[model samples]
Target: MNRYQADVPDGLSRRARSFVRVHGLRVGSLAVEDYRSEWLERGIPSAEIDRVAAFGERWGGLALPPSPRYNGGPRFFTPDTPETDPSGGWWFEAGEQRASVPYGFMIGPDGEFGVHADRWVPLHATVEGWVESLSLTYHARLWAKSITKLVHDEVETIDLTGYVEVPEVVGLADSWWRGPDSLVAIYRGEAECLAFPAARTAYIYSGLDDWGLHG
Candidate 1:
């Protein structure tokens, strides 16, 4: 079955279109699991993979981390997978230490997106086509962080609900969040949470309710 209503457009990478055509724009598509691990993989069963599919059908699926392998890019597992904690959301079971929560931005007309019970919940977006989807997701992520950009020297951000076009973008989540010098916090929605260490720093999400966090 065709996951999208139309064909792949432009702007998105060849990888994004490949993903959309084969996997139907699912956030879980990036999940490369270690099913044979002693460590546990815990998450909300209600994360509802179908919801991701539905979102992809409506808004647009995003090309997530894996490129540049940083700036929020989720790295492929090394020798040891990360820890799994059920209390918060989905996570690979490594040790006392946990893996970075995987996150992806979903682009929709309302500027809204989806997440799992996990805090760094992945997302699913539905949109016109692959090329069109990338720009939408890129713009939407900037909007979520409440960041601003210059288009012809005018402060601008893409707003699907308004008179806007998906602006040019690359390195989607690269440097998407940084603050207080050498530290940052990335929030996907209320569902997922995570805590991890980077170069001389760390990120922690308590998994608290964030119903209005976007507002």
Candidate 2:
């Protein structure tokens, strides 16, 4: 059986669900007790534990496709591997970069997805948002008439004057904006949050319609 065809965990956007169905490679699943034991012992909330368990049952160790704008795709982990943030919130090591990056991906107390380095830098308000953003990137590029990438200082020049932030992704340092005929994605997670400003990047997907933006 194709593991990718297995049901995706709930609580994700339609786009994210589709992406996981089409592209996800499920390595394995973890039991609920895997999370409850380690996290509950540390005073992690029960509600949050439920959410992680649900996600882990389907998506744990799932391998995602690479993002052109980012270092590497995220490889999700089981919730048994837990860590505490310097800010005093207990977090689960939800995912890590496929490439060698100094920081690891984390799910904070409030279900926010971020990287932990000198400090925690939230990339999105929720783990679902992160998956949605990746799905959008994959979808947008397929239908976009043209794509443009900006690096370093050039990323600062692309004006978002009339663009509106896309709400589904719940962006923080990393964001997606929709213009009249284009969608712009800005990646500042490593640059702004991890203190590597030179790594700033953005992508412009132009000549899009309502369907291209939302379909």
Candidate 3:
């Protein structure tokens, strides 16, 4: 079994399996410093830098400049958020708020990080297999966003063939086969959105102004 499979919930729907595999590979490519630098470089502007400071605190400490690094953090997902779903794996960075409203990337659970997800796949609902059901869909006509995943697995093979570009997951929930070659991928711009009979959750940005989604 692949190292990523050790943590995968064995019976996950095919799409779920694909999700985990893709992200496991992604997380493996990153080192500890990448996480810290991303926050410091793209971090929201603040005088005290308190948000990143506290965020780093959860990770133990924040390193900077030549040897910046985040120490003692979860292997998958950021430290849990306090105000919302304590059950969620990560909280959207609260610092990048736009027009006074929170707008940032978040993963793990619906409504936990100010992201309202439309359920496409209904798993057991505990969040164990939850992270395995996320992917990116970009709308470049509006803004740019880079998808990120946190996983730890080593693999020599990563097949990029599973990606597809579709119109909508909402349309596929009612009709998609469970065949070996079955997949319903939606692409808005340059990114592909993985869709499934059991995977409709997404960070909703359609109605929010001064706010939009990158993935």
Candidate 4:
């Protein structure tokens, strides 16, 4: 049997299996609340909090309030769309240089269940010499303003490691529902390598030692 078939537990839906197939491995799973706390601990400023708060005030309270039960997880932010065609959004930055990467959350609509955006680079691209090395993509949709009576107020942390064989499991969630799959590689961090997936939200971290992949 393929390693993935062996590693993947039974009971995942077809959609879920498709997700796992596109991405290699499942790193670690956690509740939305846990993910948020980790992001904060990682030094990501609470930029989303301020933005949501300001929006609420400007709009005479938010159409929906932030809820961890629905929307909260590791998030990416972009100033605008990366397409040659212009889309009005935020520009993404990596160190001193800037790229047209999109940034957002990996959460559900009700303001609970997933990830959120902070001031840090949720998904970043790496450059090696004249060529771009990696590309991280993301997709998210709003579920509801709140799910249960309880309101959410935290981000979640999804631990990532290098060496997952599937592309979708490399990052966080699978990108099946999102438009199309995207790939990204991190060459500067503790893991220096490249990866590609059919989805934007998932990734495989291959540690620092093994930087190349071969069949």
Best model per TM-score: 2
Best-matching candidate per lDDT: 2
What is the C-alpha lDDT profile of model 1 across 1-215, one tens digit per residue? 44432344444555455544543332222222323222333432333333333333333333333321224332211112323335533333111112353543233222222322234332223222323333333333433434333222121122223212222221122112222211123222222223232211212212222321121
Instruction: Enumerate clash totals for all models, in the order shown.
Output: 23, 0, 7, 54
lDDT per residue (tens digit) for residues 109-214 in model 3: 3322222233222221322222322322222223323322211121112233543322223222111111122232221110112222222222221221222221
Which residue runs does candidate 4 get wrong by more than 4 Å? Answer: 1-22, 28-100, 108-215
lDDT, candidate 4, 1-215, per-residue tens: 44322142233434333333443332222223433455457644456433333222222111111212112212211111111113322222211112222333321211111122332222211111101111121111111121212111111122323323233323222211111121222221111112222122222222112112211
Question: Model 4 TM-score?
Answer: 0.18
| lDDT (Cα atoms) of all candidates against the true structure | 0.29, 0.78, 0.28, 0.23
What is the RMSD of candidate 4?
A: 20.2
Candidate order, TM-score descending? 2, 1, 3, 4
Q: Which residue pairs collide, candidate 2?
A: none
Model 2 off-target regions past 4 Å?
Answer: 1-4, 30-54
Q: Which stretches of candidate 3 lie over 4 Å from their true place?
A: 1-6, 9-11, 26-76, 84-101, 104-215
> Residue 28 CA error for candidate 1 (Å)?
19
lDDT of candidate 2? 0.78
TM-score-wise, the better of 3 and 4 is 3
